[model samples]
Target: MKKKDKSHSHSHLAFDHVSFSYKHSDKFTSVFDNINLTIHEKEFVTILGPSGAGKSTFFRLASGLEQPESGHIRLRDKEERHRLGKIGYMPQQDLLLPWRTVLENGLLPLEIKGMNKKEAREKVLHHMKKFGLLGTEDHYPHQLSGGMRQRVSFLRAILGGNEILLLDEPFSALDSMTRYMMQEWLLEQWHEWDKTIIFITHDVEEAIFLSDRVLMLTHPPIKGEIDEVNVPISRPRNEEHRSDAAFMKLKQDLLKKMRSKERSL
Candidate 1:
């Protein structure tokens, strides 16, 4: 697939020469070293790499869950020191509170923002049908299927009111068929919501199917620029696109790259 030219697009989020390290035992181990990355407005970008490749760390720094040891993280081209509530984040696990009803869980972000209880409930209810969570409002997380739980988690993330969403392998735990369905549903939601999505996934096909571009993070202690490939498949993609020649070729290429990196480790 040819790399898409993103030179003209507006930068929505950027990591400007950011450096970060983790404290382990008595020493600090580098995760990212003077790395810079820019995600354009409304673009869906996927990060793929082996385990411990700093993928989750990238999300943490981008979402401001963790601060860089040096350099700046910017959103909308403006550097902000504190950015937690400004971005929506969905972790690998659905992380829905087991005791909370679907409605209660979906209202968490609005609640945190001090929205009126009645207004927040109304807002959550309004999107219930669209999210395929209408009748499950009173059900606890434990009562819902894995896919249903994830839908609730997704609803909660968007209600955070952020235009940029960071999703860390959200479908990894689902069955294969369910995962595929969720990917399709996610694209529909992305189109309607018009938000920039930065997704992390171990699945090459998922990355190609869902992203405008796929970014590969080398092993930990990553430095300089990240390797990337633009997804050539056009938007509003369907299941038939998966069988296209370009899609198969790209999948093989990505798998080869990932395997080489894993072998190096």
Candidate 2:
């Protein structure tokens, strides 16, 4: 008998030949066919594609918000298998409650999980300080700048002690300068937490800047899988790197892939 390989035996998370089509529809259009992918522990993977490439759908599947029509999603977290609460999702909008103070908002998930108020407050405040929202704990969402609100949302996403983060265009709403600063801040925070992150973005530059591996999708509902592009850029990336030849080359290559894929359709 042959010995089994652990990597081949199972994955941290896997979409095995997964296919999804909307329910209760005559068209029964297929989003993807035989889609297979996996994310290992603490790997930073960015899903990049044009609108409607099933990028959002992928996140939904990974986070257990939606199930596959066919095939299976095997998340190897035996402790909390297929549990939605195990994943942290930050949607496109900050979605902060206007009435709740920033601290309360960050502590909501912890409270729901039955953590004591004092413990939740301590954890939320620790993240707030780590992620640069320390002084805004009492402020309402409307009182903060766009960047600050995003920081709060990020804190909330991680507060529940979720190991995997599903980021759906979290920084798309910011101005250019603010977006860049937030990106840097996010990179620093990810370092401190060491969580698995699957970030969805149509912006190739943003994807490349933050991701260790960028997964490019093809068009249509569920038509294509990711074209994994490794970003060789060093950590603590800055404004200066955007002008570097290597960065530009990777950017241009991503554009080319996008254009070629688009033209194919």
Candidate 3:
């Protein structure tokens, strides 16, 4: 694990002593208990855990889809009361409107913001090539491959013009080769856009490949603290780095930890 860099001191998002729970059928189930977490600006952070470990719940809280029962969620060092629409979010599924063309889907956020149709189209068009959707403007969701659909979904998320994005297993549905290619493409986009990304995934290798830090939520109903490891590998990582000795060791360690946590549950 790498040491925290002093240069990256400023946190773009933070959860301060936050607690949350859900009520179902006269039963209240707790998810978080006084948890504190900090994500730095422009950082690539991944949350890894077993199923039912509250990973989705974490994202929901971060994106403001659900609020904490106690404590605070801070954006840019200030607590934000209404966080919905303030942060971009891409769920596991593409969630694209099948009836809308690629161009129209990508323009949804900007349009919702009340930007003029002509200006929104211009803005989305300017980014089509960057998002690898230049020629598919008129294509519908069904006409595009899984990878392309994800790109369109991502484009829509970013069009919201937020500095932070919450991506929930966005590439988990793609084939292995396509998933790898999309991972590389995502890094390029992250570099170009300079956005802080909080990604959730069950794949250990995926977490190691894309994140500066991997946060592990071992068991459900988390209390006070969470485990984390910083990826020591250098930036501009590629396929070659996956085979590096450190990468392999880290992967093994993370897998071991995950397995142990699962067994404990």
Candidate 4:
């Protein structure tokens, strides 16, 4: 189940025969079994699954926050198994420090890397404008909208300076209108940053709208190959695409496939 690609550009992230589990008491809860996949540079990939399907577990493994029981999680810049800071990660919650201002929070990653505070502030300020957080730099998380907090969280991940990002339902908590706006803004940022991103979400429409391809965790304790659906619609997509025939068809198909295990949970 191991995948090897020598191509310098497309093969930016590789999950080689990765198997993982969580130990609970005397029993081991199986999460993944021999998972193999490759995420290309600048590609946006979303993961979808029913509740309790281990979507977050995969993210933990990808982010190097937890180790797989077996197999390799390799990045383009390295060959060994150590990953750690090679990829930036954002969790479901904004996880912004309420005590810190937006700009200061975004600069946490840089500071952890021993970067100078003044220098990091300058860099964060420059990107804050692009993220639409320019005038709100001094505002705390509690003072901003939900969408604004997420933008700050994303800014923190970006400041980590990894070409790959792991996001776990980063926008699921916002209201419908705010979620839509965040999605549009995130897509714009993705296009501009040219970074590879792997996202986890339960929302079918969000997965389809945001990803170049969607991976469905069809089988739990899933082994070997998994279901992957490519978005046929072109990029720079707008709200109109949701009404397009191709989009609806793909949506229906993916929904059907993903719902197969819904009743089990």
Could you estimate the TM-score for every candidate? 0.90, 0.84, 0.90, 0.86
Candidate 2 lDDT over 33-52, as tens digits, reads: 77878787666789998777
Please report how far candidate 2 places residue 110 from its true position, in Å: 1.9
If ranked by TM-score, best first, what sequence of candidates would result?
A: 1, 3, 4, 2
Of candidate 2, the 10-residue stretch with the lowest lDDT total is: 1-10
Better of 2 and 4 by lDDT: 4
Tens digits of per-residue lDDT, candidate 4, 94-196, equal: 7899999998898899999999889999999998987778999889999998778877898898899888889888887678987787788788878877778
* Residues 152-247, model 1: lDDT tens digits: 887888899899999988888778987888899889888887888999998899999999999998698988887889888887888898999999
- Candidate 2 CA-lDDT value: 0.79
Model with the higher lDDT, candidate 1 or 2 = 1
Candidate 3 segments exceeding 4 Å error: 1-6, 126-136, 142-147
If both were scored by TM-score, which would come out higher, candidate 1 or candidate 4?
Answer: 1
Stretches of model 4 off by over 4 angstroms after superposition: 1-9, 114-116, 129-147, 261-265
